[model samples]
Target chain A: MGDGPSNEKGAQIMSLFEVLTIIVPSTLLTAAPLIFTSLGGVFTERSGVVNIGLEGLMGVGAFTAAVSTLGLEHAGLGDASPWIAILFAAIAGGIFALIHAVVSITFRADQTVSGVALNFLAAGLTIFLVKMIYEGKGQTPYITHNIDKINIPLLSKIPVIGPIFFQQVTYTSYLAIFVSILVWYIIFKTPFGLRLRSVGEHPAAADTLGINVIRMRYIGVVLSGVFGGIGGAVYLVTITSNYNVSTIAGQGFLALAALVFGKWHPIGAMGASLFFGFAQALSITSQQIPYLDRLPSVIMLTAPYVLTLIVLTGFVGRAEAPKADGVPYIKGQR
Target chain B: MIKLVKKINWMTLLVPVISVILGLLCGAVIMLVIGYNPILAYQSIVESIFLQPYYTGETIRAMIPLVLAGLAVAFAFRTGLFNIGVEGQLMAGWLASVACAIVFGHLPRVILLPLSVLAGGAAGALWGYIPGLLKAKFKVHEVISTIMMNYIALYTTAYIIKNFLYTEGERTPTIPAAASLASPFLANLTQGSRLHWGFIVAIIAVVAMWFILWKTTKGYELRAVGFSPDASQYAGMNVSRNIILSLTISGIFAGLGGAMEGLGTYQYMTINSTFTGIGFNGIAVALLGLNTPIGVVLSGALFAGLQTGGLTMQSNAGVPVELIQIIIALIIFFVGSGYVIKWAMGRLTRKGHK
Candidate 1:
């Protein structure tokens, strides 16, 4: 696939159409899990709870999916059932999320520490589980076979956005985008959205207005867990297609960055996620691009993180958080 | 004397002890649920950390960095800066020291070792200063910058080790004997094992931190700024300069932590891995220590004990080393919830219990 002055696809200057093809398809594949995670962050932060453990939650979810796929394959289900494996991953990720929720939200602990704890927890636990399950092997079985790829025949042929992008996009990307829209609508237009936002912006005020702040925070956290779980499962199945130690890597943090970068808006989060996915995909494509590839590898790995730094530093909601995100909302005595 | 003892910050001492006990109790419950032999695991943990001298030495070795890392966090905590880049700083220190060793391989130990240590500290200071500068100048949150710095540090350290520092054969050059600070005397104390002068260095570092943080006028300025930057500014303190200084000193301590691991312990650095978890561990150490130098040293040693013994629990008791990590999480969770502990204490006191 060396496109540099070598052959047919190589010699032709990359058209905007060709660029969109390569960028879009890969962007969605990478963006799916990020969308789910950032969306989860949106809910949590909006409801006034910061979910730092998204990384750990995703790690646990990814590992659990891998383990479940193998266990299911061993249990006569065979490797053909990606759905079952993904389901198992969701459950595992949820359980992991629950650990963070219970520790941070329920117990009213420092959210950051709890989040960091989750990362360590997942790191240690996953490796330990790997040792136990694989005995000595560091990874689970490959999954590209079972992971289904969607093919929208007609949609695939559309000019710039079709074949290269739409045709190869995973089912999860579509689901993630839909979920973002759905979350935005629910958060903005629905009664529950107002309540969640109210609780975040001013928990005490919301409580005065008869909203259950604790309950809302709990709901927000639980929902976060669900999204995180989905993020993990989708990451393994759609993006990596196999589970290893570093499989989950920085995706959870990327989702957090997307959440911050998107200013906590669900739809905006989608755009932010696409940007990150494009940057990440571009890092790899740097090898193919003539002048772009000249950038150092260190800079390439750092591109996404540096972008996160810039976005968080400059663009995040400097206005104000929903007043009581980190503070534990007491019932009354205030 | 009794009255004075009562006046001392009991919370500082009791908090960690109480949390550790609670953590182990919770861990025991988890172990029971998993159907693991909790008793055997606990026995092995104690044996590994306390009963065996060599094992204890390993724990102390681990604690050196933990304490230093903890001091790094506590230094910022005192200033309300919450320097989260300790991990990044530690990595920077490790990279700087290792690079020094590689580049200045021919110097005598006297110059080489001191220069290497200084280089590590300087690198750490540089890493710490980035976020400090960002916060001081642009109002960019140090938390975000430091976290980003961590990712940058990880990848860069990995690249440097893999591409630049690794010997021609792909593995890094073995640290020369003269360059290594591992001492036979210290090793004998640990059953002729890997224990070294680093532990002593860690203690000395802790004392120095204590002096810098408590006795010095700069320390007073930092604490004042922590309480109220506005007030400190009114009192003629340069808040921005303090921010930068706080981070620089913090970074130096973290660099020393890396030196402990590198010159004193490993003698060579391995990259592309999670070599800088010490920075994260420092947060916990700072919390456990109540941001006091002595407390941090104690907490760091305890954490080191956990690390070394946890490895033992993995190899000997067949308990996953991750169990220690769970204990750590539980500890952090409990520490963060001081109100919960205070309430528990209040209830127990009311009930006429100790």
Candidate 2:
């Protein structure tokens, strides 16, 4: 009971609801970044553009958000102004997405390769800016607490579930969820959605239908960029609250998995993202449990990726991606 | 004639030139936004690393891994496989080479050096095969599987480094001078330069790969499979076997990269100390090279130059080394959308003819 492992074990085994209480909220919070990026990915893929640089775009968003958030605070707006940070992050993310759109839709470059380039460029640019400004201390000053967590008034009073699931979460998770719903509607319900999906499924056919594949893809990729930016900003403001190299870490890749495992469906991807988030939460939670606690930390870190692998192999059955997802559409292929 | 010349490969050169200029211009704009002297900074970047021979040698040291890693990815890319696992493969190669060097410290250089190099490559090949097997056998998606394998390789390598191999501060040892592939005579001939014969070896490897890729039956088979696996399978090519073979070849390239790092520079490998991300960077190398051996070498040099200059930019201009990573990411964006480029170029040439 005295040792760290024993106490950790005690915490791990306490009760079913206890695990859920800790897990549900953290999972949502963890899933928030993925949710935003997946929405971004879904946007592009549905419109027949595959944005692999969402990770890079997200990194850009995170770095810019951190700097601007800090800047805003210095300018006396205070760190509590997440609204301003989010706007700034959107611009940052948008800029990266615009670059992706130009190379991919306009230049007709390889979508996957372009995304990778964005990642490198963002990483280099962010690190350069951080170092040039912050002088290699590895990160920026932590965001003020006021700039972070906001508890809902009536929601907070709704018993155990409220505080655990709703109280502690950054507003980004809620925004991502709202956007996921909005994206679902936008991808499947509206006229723009139809054109986007049509372009994705068969660009030539869509072209015959008078749909502009390039324009749709550009919108899709740029939308992804916007969401990716929000994801990054949210990640920094809510989770890590400080900018560092490892701050973004492997979250981008995991989110990519979430997007894929969701089979490119907006709602389905939400479920997948939640699953990954829970896996991450469980990995941390297992630290307290005795039987699993004895396992190596490497095993713990490997768990989420392994789960992704399993999900990919299992549920990724017949993942009918957009026909033009990675294919650059030529006006006269025939 | 001028237009015809421009139509041939001029755009390939043109795009890169335009991209470089634009990328630099964007870089300058960002520098200004953040309040820095872009000209002085860029100048320092050009001078600080290139002007100094020692720095240039160190840059070459970095370029070795980039070149090999790029080859690994370039091999896979040409085979129609996107290998995200190069990072892990490279790490595995390092681990294997280090294990051989540490355990067989007394072996003569003539036999041991080659043996260690082979062992490193073999390890990476095995690691690389995991995804190939999964993709070929289980009908799994290669992209997801490769990414997962990367994690497995990284964690497995880290675990091995911690508990089994690199334990008790014995993770690194002073490599015997006998183990060095370089001669002191050659070192002196380079004017106190660390530019080892390894650079020469890398060049040779590139030329050899170019031969294998373009001048061999296996190369034809690989290219055919890459063109369309279903069609190749219909034509009696073993799709599964090719997938496995391509990955194995790719892994060998990565493994050799690790071996180079160990043999050429470190002379001994240390856990957690090998240049990480070089494998991932190899993908960038392949992209920049447009999936050719010569392209890989040139792109590797370009990247090497940027990486070298990036450090200087950090020290002098307050730019982050990670900015280079972002640039690489941007390049990947363009490369991934290669189809777009082909389309646009076609349109341009067609319009020109009209």
lDDT of 1 by residue, B1-354 (tens): 987577345744666789998988987887787667778888887887778898887877778788889989998889988777898888888878877877888999888877888888899999888888878876766766787788888888888888877865444566666567789888888896688777777788788888877899998999999999999999999999999898888888888788777787778777655445788889988987888888887778778887787777777767777778878877887787766786777677669953
Give one digit per residue, the lDDT tens place, for model 2 in B106-156.
998787777777888898899788788777876666666777777777777
TM-score of chain B of each: 0.93, 0.89
DockQ of candidate 2 against the true complex: 0.47
In the predicted model 1, the residue pairs found to clash are: none
- Please give the lDDT score at residue A238 for candidate 2: 76
Report, to 2 decimal places, the DockQ of model 1.
0.53
Candidate 1 TM-score, true structure as reference: 0.90
lDDT of 1 by residue, A174-277 (tens): 88899999999999999999999998888888999888888888888877877887888888877676777688877887788788667788987888888888
In model 1, the runs with Cα more than 4 Å from the true position are: A1-10, A14-20, A71-80, A84-88, A129-145, A241-244, A315-322, A331-334, B1-8, B168-172, B175-178, B230-236, B273-275
Which predicted model would earn the best TM-score?
1
The stretch of ten residues in a row with the least summed lDDT in candidate 2 chain B is B266-275
